[model samples]
Target: MRGSVVCKKIAPVGEVLVKVFPTEIIDSVGEEDAHFFGAIDTATRALRGGGVFSVSDEIEGAALLHYINVAESYRNEGVGSKLLDYSLKSMKSAGTKYVLYRETADNPINLIISYNFATDNGFIPIVENEKILSYKMETILGGKFAMKMMGKKDSLNNIIGIDDPKDNRIIKFNEDNSDVFYKLEKGNYDPCYSGFYVKDDKIVGALRGVLRDKTVILGDVYLETGYESDDIYTSLLEYVLILLTQDVRVENIVIQVTGEKRRSIINSLLGEPDAERNAIELVRYL
Candidate 1:
């Protein structure tokens, strides 16, 4: 009998994640990573053969298939496929945009097994860097999400390029509206060189940055909903760059984007995306 799948909207803790994967895989990823994974929603499927598989819709809108551990007795029973299918369906309903799976270890046996499983199940390689393998989900929500995003092209363009109407001035982030700054930076926020674009004395757009070790790490660069035809980010970035350069220690500026679309836009604005080192990121259309 094939076990039924169960998808949970809440994320699992480190202990639960450990139970889902083998010690070898956990060691490769390190227990520290559990903090990041534990914050997102999870899906788990129980196999009749006493196996279980699990995944999480994590950061960057990618449903990361973290682990699948099936009993040796259940290896060829198609339990994995069933579990993945149900997980994908659940993710689709929840508006998941991507499905990601990564393998960090270089073990040939594990590599071949995981790669073949992903490929045979309609997962395709999106990025491979060194020993890491990243895959994008293709079956359930991939195409659907693509179309949804395509329809929003104009809105996204407006949001990304929105500017203040009253004035084109960039003001320093002060204690007066620090609360507003925190409100806009939803996640993974590090507010260092913070500023905003004002219109009629209201903060309509914001640019956040972090200065560490002589490098300015550009944080969230965003505008409020509905404003259009603004160059707030470009202006704020230029302002911060000039401000940071005044210090003799400042050497470089790096924009740490949360997703591919934002990364592409930021890189295009900044001119010349750095190719010093490559990173492996998995993406799915859904």
Candidate 2:
């Protein structure tokens, strides 16, 4: 039974997956959660001995390990390890730089097991609570940072670096920005919440944000391919930080970045990772 187990990606169908998957995920798959399993890059699968796993596509530059379940009978037989190994390999091949996993922390025993499992597989618990546990894959960073923000008050003009009073105008994202947005998107930027960086009446950069469950998730701090520079990055993130500081109800901030360039920028702005109360998120880096 041990050596015979094989792991592979499978459609989110069949008795094996349905039997082992969590009830909520089973329902979402039934409803066709494209966000969860729609992309060609996403993997949803079942393994030998009634085990199942799923990895979301690289959304906002990171893939999420959204689901994994091994039947009780298969728990001690290495099924989880086999499924995780396959999923990580596939995700890395798909150009995923970061991966994340989340587990409920309501049960102390389960939380401990989950934490141990994550660390064993190169993950670190960033957010630990009785309600939720967040784990991110561990990596050797140069060091940590202490967060800082500019003291001056920020507005659209200041954020866009518009010094000329004659050319100054603030463009908050709305229906009017849609035209310029689609042109810049070029099939890359799809934002649920965002701010645009305009300079001299032209859009030079964009800040994308998505709010989910009281957490504001940042997507892209994008300037055109060759047009990127350090200041542009700072202005964009500073705007988001200012906005978040103004909101009293926002519980957390998540930035999803693809390569070292953006990751470095995020690290600089955030100045080190801090866990939110009772919150859980999963993260991995390639």
Candidate 3:
């Protein structure tokens, strides 16, 4: 993938088509988590050689860019820089308000200078907690479970009431006569469109999904305190499996949580290790 390409705007098309580069070109970036965009040549009506690959998610009204690369054959011909310019322009046209990018702290060359590129383009660095190795479990049992969509107003309030009393300040559930409930009810809140497990109209647990290309990521699984019922947890896992089965685009489901809390749960549900690795660091745009 190298060369000059024409950029076209296709209307009535919700998804934009830039250029399509060989998947190998993108895999060379050495990160499995990257998101990619390409530019197409106007004259040839084919994808240009260079493209931009980064990490992006629908949080904080911005996309997080991790790495930018141009085909080796086309380096220093302004193709790479032009691709960056095109990416920003395209995102702006799509109504994106911010762009966040990062370079590994141990990068071998020009780490500071590379960060400057994003800074010059109006991006800023935000500090976050560094990740560490967490234990992994192989399998977990599957069982019957039910799912329901609940408004945050009722869910958050109920969760707050049941949480450990010592940690009540962690969430302002009932203060001010439940202002959080009011905000959730008035549409001023979005709890990331999560899914829940309920029995008899009472929420037993909850889960949320994040989509990345062909993956449906699940996280933030929480169960009501003092409700150590196996049925409740099983129901939550079953709900997750049902949702995953319905997503045709997803090839794999990934869940991340603290090693201590998830070890047993993962063993019971996921069963046998497919792969286990540690996340060294993680950053979110929001």
Candidate 4:
């Protein structure tokens, strides 16, 4: 059974994919989710084991290992290793700097970053971006964002903090005023989906986002640590959300934020996330 599997690139993607992956896995994945995952770049199968991969569009030089399934018959037979090895090699040759796998933390398999597999493949856990990052946010907010897109403000009524929009402090972000943001040169900033809340002639708070595929990834919510920090952060986020839908077609919202205050406010606005553990971002640098 071990040598029967012939791992290769671009395995057939139609009925064969569904047959390879269990119904629970493939059926739950939507067309938009597949599109957002990006790149039909790879699929591998033989002897009843296969996986799907996509380029991580929001994170430069990275490929996402979206799914890997080994049939119960083929389990523990090394087919999974061959598929991963080939996938990493393919990603590296194509100039992907790293491969990322995201999943809820502290599961039996640590979710997608399986421990035994990570040890085998040299993937490492990263703590840097956990405070404000996740693909899972899509699952929670996608429908509400769709409702917002349909001009149903009433649907998200309570969380819509600032409807007036007359606050001059909330200025659009651009290269010229990028200095107002704390880590401007290092962080991702696009004029269209970013703004700042200035008060007392200072940048008291700011909000930023990156638009990828159909989702607007809102992140880098910053504010001066002060008495009014809560209000400032809330207003800035609401401003960005409103700004996003009014100007562009926003089908989904992926938030990159954590911590007590941040999560509390986000929950108030978008509802509670799984929140028990941070979404783990595992990377294998090439």
- How do the predictions measure up, each by TM-score? 0.37, 0.44, 0.37, 0.54
Q: Which candidate comes out best when scored by TM-score?
A: 4
* lDDT, residue 90, candidate 4: 73
Better of 2 and 4 by lDDT: 4
* Tens digit per residue, CA lDDT, model 1, 1-286: 3434333332435566555556665664455543122111123343222122233412444456655545565457675676566566666676666677755443556666777777787787664432211112221123233343333333232222213222323333223334332343223233335555666656666666655566666654566566423355555554554444445665556554444554444444443433222233333445
Candidate No. with top lDDT:
4
List the global CA lDDT of all models: 0.46, 0.51, 0.45, 0.56
Tell me the deviation in Å of residue 28 in model 1.
11
Pairs with backbone N, CA or C atoms under 3 Å apart (clashes), candidate 1: 97-286, 142-286, 162-230, 163-230
Model 1 stretches with alpha carbons more than 4 Å out: 1-20, 23-60, 132-282
Tens digit of per-residue lDDT, candidate 4, span 95-201: 88887776555453455446457557778765333544333445444635435344434323323222223333333323234432234332355556766665455
Query: Which runs in model 2 stand beyond 4 Å of their true positions?
Result: 1-3, 14-16, 28-59, 128-282
**What order do candidates take by lDDT, descending?**
4, 2, 1, 3
- Model 2: per-residue lDDT, tens digit, 1-286? 1335566655555454545556666665352531222111123233433222344433334565656656565577666776677777776786666676765544467656766776777765544332311112121022231125545445435354332223323233323344332233222332434556766666567776656567776654667555588777777777766666556556666665444565566666554555322334445566
Please give the range of 10 consecutive residues that has the lowest summed lDDT in model 4: 34-43
Model with the higher TM-score, candidate 1 or 2: 2
Show model 3 residue runs off by greater than 4 Å. Answer: 1-20, 23-49, 52-68, 75-82, 99-139, 142-206, 210-216, 220-252, 258-272, 276-286
Q: Scored by Cα lDDT, where does model 3 land?
A: 0.45
lDDT of 4 at 157: 31
Q: For residue 99, what is the lDDT in candidate 4? A: 77
Pairwise lDDT winner, candidates 1 and 2: 2
lDDT of 1 at 269: 40
